[model samples]
Target: MTIIKNPVIPGMAPDPSIICVDERYYIATSTFHWTPGIQLFESKDLANWQLVGYALNNEEVNLRGTNTPAGIWAPHLSYDPQTKRFWLAYSHMVNMAGREFNADSYAIWATDIRGPWSEPIYFTSIGFDPALFHDEDGRHYLTILEWETREGYQAPGHIVLAEIDLPSGKLLSPWHRVTQGFTTRGCAEAPQIYKHQGAYFLLLASGGTGYAHGVEVGRAETIFGPYEAHPSGEPILTSSPRHLFSLGDPDAGHFEMVNPHSVMQKAGHGSLVHTHTDEWFMAHLMARPLEGQLLNPLGREASIQRMHWTEDNWLEMEDGSNLAKMTFKGLAGVPIDNEPNTDLFDSFQEPQYLLEFMTPYRQQHQSWVSTQKRQGFLRIYGGNSLFSQMNPAIMATRATSFTYEVETLLEFQPNHYSQTAGLGLYYDSNNWLYAHVTYSEEKRCPYLTLLQAKLGQRIEYVNTRVIVPEGNIQLKIGYDHGIANVYYRLEEQETWQILLQDLSVAYLSDEGVNGMPGEIGGFTGLFTFIGAVDAHQHQSYADFAYYKVTNHSPAS
Candidate 1:
């Protein structure tokens, strides 16, 4: 039990899959297109996991035109002892641009966990969150959420089971709709199948990934069920202490919460692991909104809780209570200590930029920032408006652990008609907080001003012109609730000016603002966007001496 306060793994680190092989342990999480697709963490001890390497990189797993929140889905990781190879199954959500969410499922194999993985073996058109089970009878099965999109159907889909032929990547058994989730609420997803004592168990995640979200279970004598829901008739774990969050999508209400707590939010969707030391733990998603209000940005982070099973085959928390905690330390595989939580503070002292920076649709060219090009600074060639809900000249980091802070210093001159570059906070291309320097030839001058992406609309001229003086400058942003206040300095000797641009409504947090379903609106987290906009013919490149981001608050 690693009692990790709040998010153990942050940003879109949901639906965690943990596996123990020998004395080593591994954790794999879903990455929604911050290239270098699946993030894998290694640990000798459950409490301190180290980022060993990625499961898939852009070169290995291409997501060239993948849309925001649409590039990848919950990835399930498993090891086949017979094959002695690790298998990763994931959905490359290619159609998110059209908001279709119809993704292409893929399977990749590797002899070593840190791998030069085999070319992706195109798998069936099965729905997302595909899990593979290797049974004792030498049979392999694939279980998925068979998406039910017919009219009258609601959010939180259904579950399906099929026998998959590993060699050919085909579904040997006909897909069976196991649950419409009508009885379990709309959330019939992330299903994992296991066998113990001649009985098969199906572990599921439902309740829409919100406060009502939960980890559920059912059992069947056969792989394909005429299965029965747990006699308890409700989720095994949930966080909405208040009972306000519905367990299933609006319809399955018979087991609705008697009480709910608002403290933990968007908590559900899970996978389990029996550690090398024989301790059982479950990895699921959870969130903490800004100051316990709306604006949950640490989207579906990875959290672990301990669980126990009895000879009768019923599951419960080790302590007989279903409540999860902020942190818990369990038995160690090998004692592992960790370094203080830190992200890269990139100074171009190295030849290349750290892979942590990601662009909207395309990978920003290396020529765009290099050792030879602009001295020590990384220069973003100003290209497009930061307002488009699509690709913008933005590079951001995944918002991990709610309490961390981010700040950057930038220096640039805007010349082109629509060229604007600056430092600000961004959740996605469509929603962000920016203060840029743009030029207007009609006025025959350039100025540094504040801009923002609010309610899907780019609002400008809030304070039309605070003309930027011609010289090296610095821009800074401090964020708490996805909301931020802007500050700037003209020279090293000057004090920071509080640019009065309050980003209260920029992230689309309220009703009818910055998000699309579970994809956008729920909680995309906060990020620093250092972008260049090209509103005209000439390309504008903005030189940033060095961009520094710190979780340290200036007030501290």
Candidate 2:
């Protein structure tokens, strides 16, 4: 048998929705405030996966001014065998003031996974985490969480179901309120429906998306009714099985329920699939914290687990334990060469950018960033500063490993200090660590400086400034766990000089950054980026010769 390791897809891939069509498996994940909204991955053997494409590649949804952890929420992917098409449903969260949680949900369809997708169909504003289920009899239904806003009404409201028309974007029937939650873990969301042996099964993500997170199940004879909970009266899958009761809590960051015994945390929000080989597997979201710290810099990742049906028709882990495992067994006949390819080197020789690169808060268009502008070089015209929620000229990739290095060759001549350009590590608009090249009037030359933003507070490393003659400079960042080191070298120099050493950047994480009050901070993971800033005028730009990233170790 093949041994499948955990986290088949790593780095900020959360809320995974898995589906199999024609024996080929596909997984869609959440992107939050990042553009090219939903991430999609494809796998052939269910052991090795590759980044295929994204659902929102154009200006389908606007994320400008979207707050931290509030842009594009969970994206649900399902295939309709009747129509021979793929359907994607997602939420565009606009505001979270006073915990009102205003959002607009939409669904789009395409004939192929890499699509010329149809325009979005407005579904509901009542809640988030919307999923679509197509019955065998040619009827479609939408399942979503009805957000609760009153003083006290069972916390996060109910899981409601409604029949919908795919062609006209209309609801055919009134919403039927399903069960509030299957277990006492509360905060039930991400409702998905499955049919097995003439019984409809309802699966839920419970106990929020935090430490107490888990996957619970229920079943009923009909589509919507008084569903019966699993006989276990607990989550069928979770990282922390030593449970505590949290019935009415609305908080998504349950810091108290962290499982110290397991290396994985927040293992929940799962989606199931039956393989072509008659095997069962589930794709779920999980997180890995920094060593000896509660802060999670890598955000939630994707992991797979082997599952089986019990004699009594209830779902259970293949090992007969509810706890999530770091390693599991794969299909017997499937052979996988599990060597990870996490390194990237982009020379900008091609006409198009790499598919792994993603931008935040704004769509990537030729007006701001392009490779055709300067052949063999990436020319990025600066837009706004890193603090702005609007447009920022940043092309970043997820940090997949804890021990990695990112390097770039930048050629920029800034007339003002506001037009700086270089490489750095970014989390969001409010949290980052930048090592950039800026002009200084007193020195009359370009210099390298380190800047950091922690919890909205800016810290400048004035003592580490080193003046260098301008032309082309090579910048590099070495990151190990929570510490970072910056280095630079001139075009003619044969050796590298350290600019900043042993700088603690542990605060650039989900738990360290401050977001909506009484809620989890940021949901997106850390990113290594090559960016530019033109706060003075949108005229100055930077030309990058090449960008490279090397991973020394895996996240496990």
TM-score, every prediction:
0.86, 0.98
Candidate 2 C-alpha error for residue 100, in Å: 0.7
Off by over 4 Å in 1: 1-3, 50-53, 59-68, 94-101, 152-157, 180-183, 241-262, 332-336, 367-375, 389-391, 401-405, 440-446, 462-464, 469-471, 505-523, 552-556
Q: How many backbone clashes does candidate 1 have?
A: 25
Prediction-by-prediction clash tally: 25, 0
Q: Candidate 1, residues 1-556: lDDT per residue as tens digits? A: 2334445665656778888788677878876655567778776666556666666664655565554566767778888889888888887776633334587777887877888777777776646778888888888888887654555764445688889888678878788876643235455678888776788878887766555667778777898886777666677776643333343343322223312355456567777787778777777777665563445665667777777886688765676665666665666444447633545477766676655666655545654544557677777776556655444667766655443445555666666657777877665666677777777666666677877666567677555566665735677766555556677777644777877645564344321244454333433345566777876753667777766666642110
> What are the lDDT scores of the predictions, listed in order?
0.65, 0.88
- Per-model root-mean-square deviation over C-alphas: 4.0, 1.3
Which candidate gets the maximum TM-score versus the true structure?
Answer: 2
Candidate 2 yields a Cα-based lDDT of 0.88
- Cα error of candidate 1 at position 294, Å: 3.4
